[model samples]
Target: YAGPLLEEEALNKAAEKGLSSPEFLELCVWLGSQIKSLCNMEESITSTDGGKDVESFQLEVSSFLREMACPYSSLISGDIKDRLREKEDCLKLLLFLSTELQALKILNSKKMKGSHLEKHNEVYQEVQTICDALGLSNSSASDILPLLTNVEQKIKDILSKVQNNHVGKSLLTKPLNSEQVERLGKINDALRSEYECRRRMLVKRLDVTVQSFGWSDRAKVKTDDIARIYQPKRYALSPKSTVTLAHLLAAREDLSKIIRTSSGSTRENTACAINKV
Candidate 1:
């Protein structure tokens, strides 16, 4: 008997003191409306007359249950109004109706989900048909965007090359005289010297700025030397080296000593003992 239509406190109160005639009628009307909407019925079987009495409410509830093809529709009859006056009977009826309504809502949701899946399938089939008409491979659908992007990029590149060639031809149509060529060479030399001077000035300024920030190549080299001095070194075994019986006997003694020393000692102490050995 728990749902959006009924609150826990209200249901508890109804269980203690059976649902009032007006409250019962109101629930029945709400149930009828929900059933009609879920079933896609054009018209409601329950009456909406404001002056309806207890017997009319019961009859409407029975009709709604029957219309929904409820298995327990027989439980709701003309005498249901009297039975609902008792707290136990009212709770039983409420539970039954709530269960039926919840089932209907679940069924309707599943039906809507199935319809949505069908629509998605139809769209996929339409896309597949269009791809077939275009003579595209079945796998092309997955990579169509990448293929189109590649083609567009290639077209842009071809256009750029054509534009560059046209500009080159236009320039070549007008030849330079020997005097003009000599003047151009002199100007090029002057620009190159100016560029070199500016580049040197920029490098000097960068060096000064770095020194002001206390950063120097000498300091970096010193730090690297200190790190190398403190770092542990690992030696690799030579491929041509062979282990003799003495080496094996020494290893077995080291293992026995390590096991005895580590039994009750902390990891750091055990490591120190192993190092000493």
Candidate 2:
């Protein structure tokens, strides 16, 4: 990481001229910039320290680190005042701080990448679900908008057909005599009653089914749930069936080997048969 290089440069400079040198001040400024950038603070650290005395500058830096809740703030602040003038001690503290800040930057980058990946996966899954509902192949991400458009067009077509059917029925009824209309009305009422009776019977059956499954009456039962309830338990494979399955698998491998090694015409015929199946 850049931490080691920065520390080495700072140490070399400090060894030549001591901790109170311009090199030390530059290191402090760099550290301040890093902290501010990482925390997204608008205030300039150098501007805040301009014209301040050594004690005031130290206090400001310590307070700023504390306020930002920076990692290792307590340890760094505690050492900063006592070790600011000691070249070796000051360099060590700076090295630790720089390493920690660099680590924090890496972690933040990874978190951002992970969050973006999760969002992309969620969107992809949602698109795939939509494609499945519309019975479309989700072959590529570029197909998403076209799939949605196709679904919208299908809905529009269905609604248009329903409207036209309703209009046609109305037109047909307009030419009917009053007696015929009254007879049709009676028949409609009888059919409605019959349907209502059947609906009630189905509802009761559904309630019984729900109770059998230990589900609440208000709980929704989807097609898959009903299928699950009715699905037969699979028995363990018998020795004979196991042997048959192994033979089939072996045959599949042999067929694959044959397809790979066979002449062009034979390979094409096998491929066509596979596609047809």
The best candidate in terms of TM-score: 1
- Model 1 Cα shift for residue 173 (angstroms): 42
User: Taking the tens digit of each residue's C-alpha lDDT, what string does model 1 give over 1-277?
Assistant: 2343377676657555544544555565676676676666543535446665656666666655565565653355546657456667666666776676788899989999999888867666655665555554565444345544554565566567675544222212345678966776676667666766776676666556544544566666565564454333211212222433223323432243435545665655656554767
- C-alpha lDDT of candidate 1 relative to the true structure: 0.57
User: What ranges in model 1 sit over 4 Å off?
Assistant: 1-5, 15-21, 40-49, 77-81, 140-277
Q: lDDT, candidate 1, residue 249?
A: 29
The TM-score measured for candidate 2 stands at 0.40
State the lDDT of candidate 2 residue by residue for 1-277, as single tens digits.
2343356565677644533565565666677777667766644446334566666666655565556554654434566556355556555546655775787699889999999888877766766776678676556654456667776776576667675444222213135567976776676667666766776676667657655764545444464676565443211211121122223223432233434437887766666554667
TM-score of each: 0.43, 0.40
